[model samples]
Target: MSKKIETDNTCNTSRRNLMKGTGLAVAAMSMIPAATATQAFAQTSEWDKVFPKSDKVDHQKVPFNNRYGITLIADLYLPKNRSGQPLAALAVGGPFGAVKEQSSGLYAQTMAERGFAALAFDPSFTGESGGKPRNVASPDINTEDFSAAVDYLGLQPYIDRQRIGVIGICGWGGMALNAVAVDKRVKAVVATTMYDMTRVMSKGYNDSVTPEQRGEALEQLSHQRWADAEKNMPAYQPPYNELKGGEPQFLVDYHDYYMTPRGYHPRAVNSGNAWTQTTPLSFMNMPILTYIAEISPRPLLLIHGENAHSRYFSETAFAAAAEPKELMIIPNASHTDLYDRMDKIPFDRIADFFGQHLA
Candidate 1:
């Protein structure tokens, strides 16, 4: 376990303390009404991913239902030439606001090259998925999206359901940990470039926000509900994911990946539209990492770039998690660098971790 949550050797005591919660936020979802419930979604026929399709893997767009019944669309990746036997499988998704086409798809495609059945899917209300009122996030349902992927993989004749693993990039990394805490079937989990969206939303960066400030923000979220009611389920503008010009380097990194050609996809929430304004309402009270320690004895790998702005997310999570867990730091890589930088992403190491653990 890491002694401190830091970036560039700077640490914060408040953030570390906040991360060690009593794991009570697991059942806190009845607070918010699930606005965007399950709905019929159209699956596209064209290859709409930002990354090019790989020749070494067989890729397909598929849909599966989460426990919440939300329909999610995912790009399925598998080894092109298999020996007609059950193989270890992996479900990949994340970076919070990002679609599967950008980072998760790349991870899935790469892992498929290393001989695993990988599925990269869009969370509900984003990409080719189904949810009403456009873009939104849910602590409970989003976590279920991972298990739903596992459910789909387990049904496949080529997949070994018992030997299943999962990989989550950026914000989904935190959700991956949350999923493993509840879903014991996930034998191995590798959360790379993690971000606890709830932590960042409720506590600000490094837990800098005061209790008073949190109260004030909640007041605003309270008002937004009235605004949402007034709109009658109309498209609500997102509070985040817009570049207003000349921002910080990390935002620039995200802009480069999401707003530009490198990882731009029309359906991605981060690429153009903003996430819904009420996103913070559920995340503020719910701590996603509370049950992280329970994902023990199962091989857990938390990877992050040494210089990533969000490095502390993985650090704090690693500290809370129990045995058979390892944290791997990618030297000189930033948060978005792991998104699509094949050179920085250790596909070989990730393959080794999943291969050995799932074996």
Candidate 2:
């Protein structure tokens, strides 16, 4: 287990400026009525757009419902010059709390540019998706979110149902693997900066949390459920850790992206309220990758940054899986670097992997 390192001077300066700025104030002031917060978060200004509209692909807003009846919203991207032929389809989601407007959409647009039809979706209960008591998480529901994406992609007119694939970023990487393990319809899978949410919830980073600590966490969540039911208020926790002076570079990198103008989205749970207090309980026991080995024969590509603190999750998953699995580590990159840093993220390798597997 890697010990939490102190934040450097540069990180401290950035964090301090960020907190003192209007961003923090806006986020804090949003804690009023839940309905108002939801509305405010849903508003996306032109300046907040992450990906420029692609002229090479046709884009449309599509909706589909999961078994949970949560209406999952997705932006479908299709190549304009498909020549009326069905192309391989890629479904993407993640970085956990992020909406499709961020990394996922970028990936979808790029993949479409590379001749694949793609759909980037907001997981159930987040972004444009419909679910009550906003900003919630569920292991089963989140896992199902990927399958719902696959379902939507498989039925698309420009997509070859048999050549469907998935790309999961950050925490969604775990969900993608879990989805492929069960769906069998996903011909290939790519997990970037993957995180096993179950492992993190149960053991903390690098398994620092002891067994007793895990039990205590579960206990607290159980009690919080009762409190939430009684109060009729949404159970929320603060962000994982505040950016303070002398924190680790990885922590600072996360803060720079998720907590700042670089990646902040009003609908993002991590950007605003913490996830549901009870969310960790589901993650604690629901090991999403236990069946990862079963995904073999179907290719799995695990990409991680060499310097990413959470790289071990992908390493461990790669070791657990069977043949036809490849692990690529990008040099000098940290966990969040792969999120949106196009130059650092090995898009060529990703394109080759999908092209080969989906062929």
TM-scores for all candidates: the values are: 0.88, 0.86
Best by TM-score: 1
The true-versus-predicted C-alpha distance at residue 276 of model 1, in Å, is: 0.9
Top candidate on lDDT is 1
- How far residue 314's Cα lies from its native spot in candidate 2, in Å, is 0.5
Score residue 177 of candidate 2 by CA lDDT: 90
* TM-score between candidate 1 and the true structure: 0.88
Model 2 deviation from native, Cα RMSD in Å: 7.2
Model 2, global lDDT: 0.76
For candidate 1, write residues 1-359 as lDDT tens digits: 32222245533334234423322121122123333322333677777778888899998888889888888888999899878889999999897878887899989998998999999999988878988767778888899899999999999988889999999988899889999899999999999999998888787766766787677777867876886789776334432345777555676787888878898876776675556667668888899999988888888888888767787888888878888788887777888889989898878889998989899
Colliding residue pairs in candidate 2 = 6-246, 6-247, 7-246, 7-247
